[model samples]
Target chain A: MRDKTDKLRRIAIEPVTRVEGHGKVTLLLDEEGRVVQARLHIVEFRGFEKFIQGHPYWELPLLVQRLCGICPVSHHLAAAKAIDQIVGVETLSPAALKLRRLLHFGQVLQSHALHFFHLASPDLLFGYDSEISKRNILGVLHKHPQLALQGVKIRKFGQQIIEAISGKRIHGIAAIPGGMNKALAPSVVSTLQTSIREILPWATQALELAKQLCLADRVHFDGFASLPSRYLSLVAPNGALELYDGKLRIRNSDGSSYIDQFDPCAYDQLINEEARDWSYMKFPFLIAEGPEQGWYRVGPLARVNNCDFIPTPKAEQARQEFLALSGDPLVHGTLAYHWARMIEALHCAEAIDLLLQDSELCSDDLQRQGQKSNEGIGVIEAPRGTLFHHYRIDDQDCVETANLIVSTTSNNHAMNESVRLVADAKLSGREITPELLNLVEVAIRAYDPCLSCATHAVGQMPLKIELHDVRQGLLHWLHKDQRGDFVAA
Target chain B: MSGMKSAFSFDGIQIAFTSGQSIMQAVLDGGGYIPHLCYHPQLSVHGSCRLCMVKVGDRYLSACTTEAQNGMQVENQISELRELRLKLLEMLFAEGNHFCPSCELSGNCQLQALAYELGMTHSRFPLQYPTRKRDGSHATVFLDRDRCINCEICVRASRELDGKNVFSLSGRGSDTALQINSEDGRLGSTDLIATDSSARLCPVGALVFKQGNYAERPNERLYDTHIISETGNRRPAVVSGGYPELGE
Candidate 1:
């Protein structure tokens, strides 16, 4: 882990394990003992945009859903928004808008639930050093079946609400340009309302347990408690927090530093991605100062920092508690995820209640009665962060191109920097230990990067240890000596 | 487009539907039951049991291809059409090695039910069970060369539904032989994950489910009379099948 030369050298880790999807991380160390160059590699490329070159614009929503299983709704919404732009379907009635917001809320709630329980909870609950076999949700079930069942039910409730609104569970048919495919029937709305009410108690209990477990080991949040970075997110026209569709804004950790609102179509002017050879995930940075200079973050921490207020009372209260815990609007980036999730759940329940009261929900007319072909873009805040899907269509409106900017891409720069800070702060000028390395890896996973959605990449951690003899002035590679017993490397 | 809101408004009208459901299901659930040839109740829908063609809004469409709609009219009571459908079944019988006296499916076969339903007294088409090959690839299931109807149900079900496009018809028209997709023409060749669901949807005895053999016949089956709206719906029904309930 120590740098020997007086020049910056590249260190890369490929196929990062135990995290969602593929990703790679490459660090460039300079003579000053700091990261001179940091590039996150995002490798998976399905050419989804290329494949949609001739697809009808009407099929964009469903086609884009296949882009990422974790946040299909984000893409579905983005495509619809893009089409709404082309078709001149700008204004959504209050009822339609409420329903759209509810759908977005549902997706964020479920996706965050999945990330916490199925993905990150294992490491938190079972102590990262637990045997591989016992480091999964199923393993948790073996130890505490009732808790596992409760988590599963909460996750299912979110999905069921989605299924009730949209015809299918995975690829919801509800979101359409201008409005939705089908309005919620009275029975469906009632069922969802009842389920949400019933699950609220359980959700509260689960949240309490997560907070307790997270704080049980104070060391979990103690690592690399460095100064905060810039945050970015979307804000509603009325100044209330909006995740589905909003104007983009950037703010610093202090909350006093800010930037002007920008249109998403001008994303090229605001953000850019950097590629490194070691990892498949790319580091996306703000484009204010050139592609590589502007360091910014998206997702939970960014959302909290960028927005002035949340719509739901309970969520707003949670935001207050979050700021209390961290003192800064960025709110201790590590714990920002917990705040993001609670806010999403509260917003989801409140939005669902609002949508149910709308008269348009009871209407039988789900479709517009006719199909119109036009390009569309839908942008929404996924659980991980901001998501955008941009589509182009030809005459007769077949899809000409479908480009997507996943939530994880927005946080790429910050995540890489997080890893570098943890490595430098925790292991600088000191001997490297397996415990320290694992902690460094944990710091990166805290952001919950979805590299697969971005570049179809996976992350790999390759630890290189070199022993230097002060008398010798040179270090020897320990890899060859440990080879036969070094497992699979 | 119609303002009809009553549940029974379209009763006895035989409305044509052609989007999602199979023909046999449309006939049985749509209130008019058409005698089927080579169709099974438990397996996936197979149009090879061609006895369910009813005149759609205008053109004749296989009931299986049409998803039922609200008001489009339909009819299957034409005598000439009934006679034509029956005649085809008889032709299929005479051309194959069908011996009811020894056949195990004689009492439950869809072809047999159609014969009784249509009152077929004799087979007019000449008999010709051509010399063909039959290889028993798996230990449990046996393939009978004399029984295949060249219906392409097994082929289509395997390819489209299962995503394993294995089976294909080699020869054209009457000379078609069901070839297991391999250059060597051996069933053992290729990446045929036997667990591939294509064979599970086989209508006739061509690809029998190893577990549900000698199960209930159409007359005693509940799903036969009622449409299976959901795949895993397990409503209590006449348990004439040798196999026990799946979840049990």
Candidate 2:
């Protein structure tokens, strides 16, 4: 690969599209036609931490939800849980806990559905190298209309459940510090029960489609960004899959339990964030292993890999099938993220069904009154991964300090590593085609990283890729326009 | 006192009000609409929000402070006044740390409701991100100055209705803020009670009742089901009784 006379160059992919917020991928190359370094940079910053300082602690639940519209419920609940600490409540009321769980289930289901059907399905159903304009949700609509409709219905059902419980679907102000403010009315409970049953079939079909895709494209699924990394997620006391309330669990890359039953409030002791000058997002790693060696994966792939078993029957069956693909506890295939996401969606639907049937869901015991504490930490498994919201309040009950570890920020290292691996393997001294650049995006998308939430910005991203010669500069540039076409810029 | 009532046209609709009533009061009484942050039905009109600006005979004036007069044609819904109000809303958003997602008064906040009414998607101006302080010093009343739009509703209510003068506006222009009326400038040192009219008069999340935070779920808040334009001064009956009990 050596061409000593050739000059080194840099390739840049700016504003990575269809993955929530503004981000770019840069590839550094050596004179010998070898990839030197790959970096994922987050461009936008909303200064949520600096601005949220003076707000009251009780206002956090609703305030943090503004982090991402895609997974507002996660931030909403996570912040609420943190404020619950400030409120000095050890646990929420039974009814409040159940209601919050229902809300979370809806969030997970909708968010996963959105990722698979709206963002990823176009790539999965159509080939990865399909036409740029055709590789989108609208293309899926034109080709597989029924599947598209099912996707819409499933997402709608989840959003409706959220709206039914809270007041509105997005940024619903239901959860508060101690507990939630309102209970699910019996009428809404009945409506959810009826709708969830209908949605279950679509969720099941989604899981089936994901499984089929994984089996059919074994080479792509197995080799594409298949980095063996440690997995971390929240789990129930019994080591079952748990999203809403649980202790932190970590599984080694070789399919062995590393840490179990650690309290999330002490997350600072277990997890540490590494700041890099290249990106605004911080890379979070397990503290014991150090930053370089401790980078771990989160979200669906990690959740499925870390959990001992999924409680619901259908999801459990799907999980078993998914595990059979690797025969290892930790599945390394990045594409398997889609499979795990679908299975979780199935589980979310099943959980919603069960929760809706619980009569206590309609109970009016939504909140508990309590005195405020000066400090508190709240943690939950967001749709993207583990989220931590820590706050220090003054005697006046105002938030004096706030530290938020969002899901995307936690997966920062893994995403960058995947992007590097894909770029090194595919784009070494070659013309950067739209398909090659999209492969890098595919690696990032596998994590379902929400850059907007990571940077706390409020705009959608449009990806642009550029190649530059070391001496001459300005080789070529490709940008995805508003119409989803990769136009040569 | 004159026995006859004074009627005026607002947005092409005729509205009648008692003599000396402001245009905002007349609109509210007649079930008409005008976006306002400082004006309250039972409190003195403090047209500080400037959100209630309306065109009267080609000249723009605040509806909250301007009295309704016979044959006065008010252009509350005109495109120019609407655009001006939207701009004012944007300025209010930029001048303060109004994070709606985290605000307790989000769904019920007059500022938020008015923004939604006017379809304000995002603020055009750069955020000032002023470093405001919170006064959790009160026992039952918490004050988050960050969310305060400087509408002066709490200040007016404290001075006009409560008579305790627990709250007052201090500073100038962008630096203006609601100040607690006590030697130490803390709510805890003041005589303001949880049930004081001033405590409940805040249009934003600035003056929130302690222990009652998140008492109303997001969906059932004041403006969730009905827009402020439609609801006007008639608060939702569900929230009219104050915070709901955990078992209610």
Candidate 3:
């Protein structure tokens, strides 16, 4: 058999930087200088499911949060919802439900705001092709100090909401099996009430800035790494945008509906996950579509496109303008994710403002009683997309089996496809350019793919772009680390 | 000591106790600290965990089992004894499936609190991930043998305090097991009520009220604010269902 690597020159971008955790993108080009294959590889294989088998069922919400640093709250809520079923509580108390919803809004708001303003802005404000040193959060602070300050305070406000209710900013113990652990203190509600007044307007400004940036470069923005594929998210019973709890909505590339109200409990029957050799992340597809044609997208762009309308007034107005950007039923541009994310941030801020006013939040009637269930499935729209946590417990209340399809896992196929399309369209020869890296990286970055996304600064990874001939190996390499300057390693 | 005198100096302080009193009881009465688990004052002494090993003269012995004597010169915090106590704590940690972060007994656990007070960072030995079974069939109580230190406090409590004889040890040495003396070998089938001393006497998170986690929040849990050595292993005011039980 002939070795396939004999003819292909590999342009390997090891560890795409600035997103939580990291991934590698490899563009394989044949001797004719044509891009042959593009693959995004996630090497991490966290055995949380297998290892968590024997833990008490209630510890799941706390345990699964370790899966994602950026969106632990999403995992926590998702697992808690599943446990609610296990413990047999059909409906949480009004007070319990409101506190959970408030926590979810805070999570979505902080995550979306941080993603748009802190991580994705530098790529937009300073053009992608700009030098790496000036294309970062620091650079945004250097030129647009006021905008940077708004991003910081808005994110802080969102986190403050989380801290107020959950006790701490992350990995907090807010939701118990049947209900929340504590009532939201009136003082905390008052403090958050004061903070949201400033955040709502700032969220509006961020949304406008995102919309403006995309408008400035319509041609590039509309087409960069864009792909037409299916979209999936959670929507309210009335077909409105819902992030915390709702039925599943799957839409076609043309904005036509596939299934609008699939039961979350039957997610395993609706979605089929296929494992591939190249990546630890599984490729999930609709049961009807099969693996080849069933690949779909889930995240900000998908959520925005799949829903009828966002519930909050300001965000609903923003969504209408977003939909107006295209004559087609849905917007497929990957860059539009930032614009949609900011819209959700505004909605979260509004939701928090609305939730804080509910007097039930201060009620002592927190817990609900229920019958015991053996299995449960929970689904929620994390800032990234739909997160599913399904668990089955033994009679002893130990987690007998667990199956999780985090938002990033659900988008694995789409992220790979987006980057592949970009590499195929942009790659001409063996040469690797900053513009090419920008487009390929931005494709996945738009997903804000939570690859071990840690906010820790102590161990920021070095990015390596390698040119390799499979036969000779390691032809040339360029490196970028915490110093933010590219070096020929 | 209770005024019965056969005086012994502990850490350069005179601690007087009756001839038949164990060193642990004397230490307690003398207002001195010696970290211990499986040595509750309310339960019969088991001396299973060697955590309270102290050097008397040239040999170390379990303080709860060793009787107080005149001119004993027992040392609880000597270099040899401190290292040995830490080794014992580390062994218990390694032998069990004790992921304290996930364990409901976390801050309230005497084993955990004692480890914290001793300044233990990590276990030197690799964890033995035993195939332990957790029993949650009981309506209100849970039994997770993963965190069980084989102390037999539950066994003693059930027989001596609750008068149920619902628990007993079934194996020997490292393989020792807590057998629920029920027709189906389950706690739910046994006469072990949630309020039974057996259900609450485990020093670790081996047994606990099923819905008791995060009841007082982390900051208010038993050992959260008070060091186990200083607080003498007493629990914080009990909070059930997010409300502190009245009449404390």
Whichever of 1 and 2 has more DockQ, that candidate is 2
Query: How well is each residue in A348-408 modelled by candidate 1, as lDDT tens digits?
Result: 6666566666677666443232234455556677777777777766543445566677777
Q: How close is candidate 2 to the true structure, as a TM-score?
A: 0.86
Report lDDT per candidate.
Answer: 0.58, 0.78, 0.79
TM-score of each: 0.60, 0.86, 0.91
Of candidates 3 and 1, the better by DockQ: 3
Docking class of 3: acceptable
Query: What is the fnat value (0 to 1) for candidate 2?
Result: 0.93
Q: What ranges in model 2 sit over 4 Å off?
A: A1-21, A30-32, A452-461, A464-489, B1-98, B111-132, B146-156, B171-176, B217-219, B224-248
Chain A agreement with the truth for model 2, given as TM-score: 0.92
Q: Best by DockQ, which number? A: 2
**Which segments of candidate 3 are over 4 A away from where they belong?**
A1-20, A30-32, A453-489, B1-8, B12-19, B55-61, B69-80, B236-248
Give per-model CA RMSD: 17.4, 4.9, 3.7
* Tens-digit per-residue lDDT, B1-248, candidate 3: 45468888788788888878889989998888788877877777889788888888889889999989987888887777778888999999999988876667777778889888888899999989887778888988888887888888789878888888988888888888888898989988988776677776677888877785665455557788888877786544352223332110
For model 2, report DockQ: 0.62
How big is the positional error of residue A288 in model 2, measured in Å on the Cα after superposition?
A: 1.8
List where candidate 1 sits over 4 angstroms from the true fold: A1-20, A26-40, A142-146, A213-222, A225-227, A273-282, A357-359, A365-375, A426-437, A453-489, B1-248
In order, the interface RMSDs are 20.9, 1.9, 1.9
